[model samples]
Target: MMKALLATVLAVTPVATVTRLSLPPPTGPAKVGVVTAHLVDRSRPDPWVATERFRELMVSVWYPARSVRGHQRADWVTPGVAARINTPDSGFTLPVTHGHLNAPAAAGKHPVILWSPGFGMERTSGTALAEDLASHGYVVVTVDHTHDAQFVEFPDGRIATNAIPPVATPAEEEQLIGKALDVRVTDTRFVLDRLRTMPLARHMDLSRVGMFGHSMGGAAAAGTMLADRRIRAGLNLDGSFAGPVLEAGLDRPFLLLGSESHDGEQDETWTRMWDNLRGKRYRMELDGSAHLSFSDFQVLLPQLGLPPDQVEPAVGTIDGPRSVAIQRAYVRAFFDRHLRHRDGRLLDRPSPRYPEIRFP
Candidate 1:
């Protein structure tokens, strides 16, 4: 929902003078390696457009690499996705990722985690978190829901842009978002199915699978977990809930993370979601964060050097590096506790190490 909403809004803002942007380094010991695959779901026809007969998706699979000494650094995003994210005229270059391209996977099978980005945002939106997790020995897969994302680039050099249109009313918007969740849920399931049999299947322990997402993608995480038992855990970052998950809460582990302004008090959806949880559930908030702080946008937008007033509307007042650090730490901790059976004690309460994280 944001490429048109935020990207269009961003177009009107004063362009930044900053020429280049770089992501922060990964915090774990293992080297990160990533591979992108173009997937075609012939069983399902394109829902947003009538001309297309099947659904096509672009997916990035990140893993713990044994060695990246000779492999090349991966682009944070494909050139096409980069253009749709930042207007070409802005003259700001996108960041490069720590992921090495097609590097060899580490020896032991690792826990698998799937990532879904915010509405209208590409999979690259969660690059910082994915890389950090992979560096910690998790198999992190990021999915870009075709036609729903701002742009998706495939291996054949073809690009697919968003096909969904704006809605005119709140009722219509709600229905459209539900439909996006429908697509996202199905996309996630299909990706999980493919991953179980892919070449990297040897590197993944499918039984230890988890999912997380930001914004609409966050809702999809809950939605997908509800629809599939294969996913052992789920997390939602500052996203509201809609559809069946609201009524049929999950029995598995789940965590709801929110920014300062997004809470059960403000969003009734969060309250309903909290009430229906039947299993282990935890909720937390980031004190100085905003909706976008849960994403890579937290790291990139600040470099724009927008007026202080303008900053709050986008990524919030929190410093860029601090936001990334908090997210990488907490998100990693949740998965480590639930998926790896490694409780790092960071999630038990607010840690002095990350003062911005609150148990609200």
Candidate 2:
């Protein structure tokens, strides 16, 4: 994760003038529809906020929609969440998304892909990927882990910031992150349970479930797969596994797509997990990408006028559109192959179109 880089950049960079931005349109055929839900897991107490008796979550479900003609498009982040993260003077308005709000789901059952964002990042940070997957006939659930997310805006107007206990030492830091990952795994399972009861549930094929995440979320994806058999395949974008996931290993289909700095040879955790994999697995490195390149930051940062020096270190040297395209292709290819039983030869070998992708 680019945690250090983000902190450094945020601390030193001067706030710019406010400019409105829009997410790149999804490349798939279907128009995307999104709905937000407030889910509560009464079975468990929140690990981060002990004062709370139940674990509450805000989740957005993106799926193939009938049309985007009259429905209102969704905001990238709720005004409250955006205000909490960005200063008023810092020309950082949340981007407008391509998804229509509460549109009717398209007919027929579709595979499901659960998404989690980086630590202290909002679930909407994965909106680009979710929209892309929804356009391609998959129902993607993006969860905002209350307290862990930078800010979760509930329907009732309550906003929750990350409440994980602070650590004074590196060991305590690891422990805190480990506990956060555990909470994320539990959150994902609860979201899955709630999805089965939704009106849109009839259009979702839960049996073909998959999960993918960026940074800490990616770590959670691997951990969730190990903990839940419902996740038939998992993808990790620039994240290293921890705790039981790193120790117990995984036997299901998993994909490790990372930035250049932490490829298979560079990261021992990746090597260990790769070797322990018992089912179909693939590992790839995007040559020009950095940790945040797999995130919406790849596009958002540049639009905000962050210089190449600052953006490139955290994201990558690749053009934002190209980065998004490459990620969308590879991610969908993996899911299409494993969950839908389609031929994903794209995963079998490197493609000339994306010379930036390296397989080891």
All models: lDDT? 0.88, 0.86
TM-scores of the models, in the order given: 0.96, 0.95
Q: What is the lDDT of residue 314 in candidate 1?
A: 67
lDDT of 1 by residue, 194-307 (tens): 996778899999999999999988999999999999999899999999999999999998999999989877999999999998877889998889888888888877776667
Single out the weakest 10-residue window by summed lDDT for candidate 1. 8-17
Residue 257 lDDT, candidate 2, scale 0-100: 95
lDDT of 2: 0.86
- CA lDDT of 142 in candidate 2? 95
Candidate 2 residue 35 C-alpha distance from true site, Å: 0.1
After superposing candidate 1 on the true structure, give the runs of residues whose Cα lies further than 4 Å from its correct spot. 8-18, 83-88
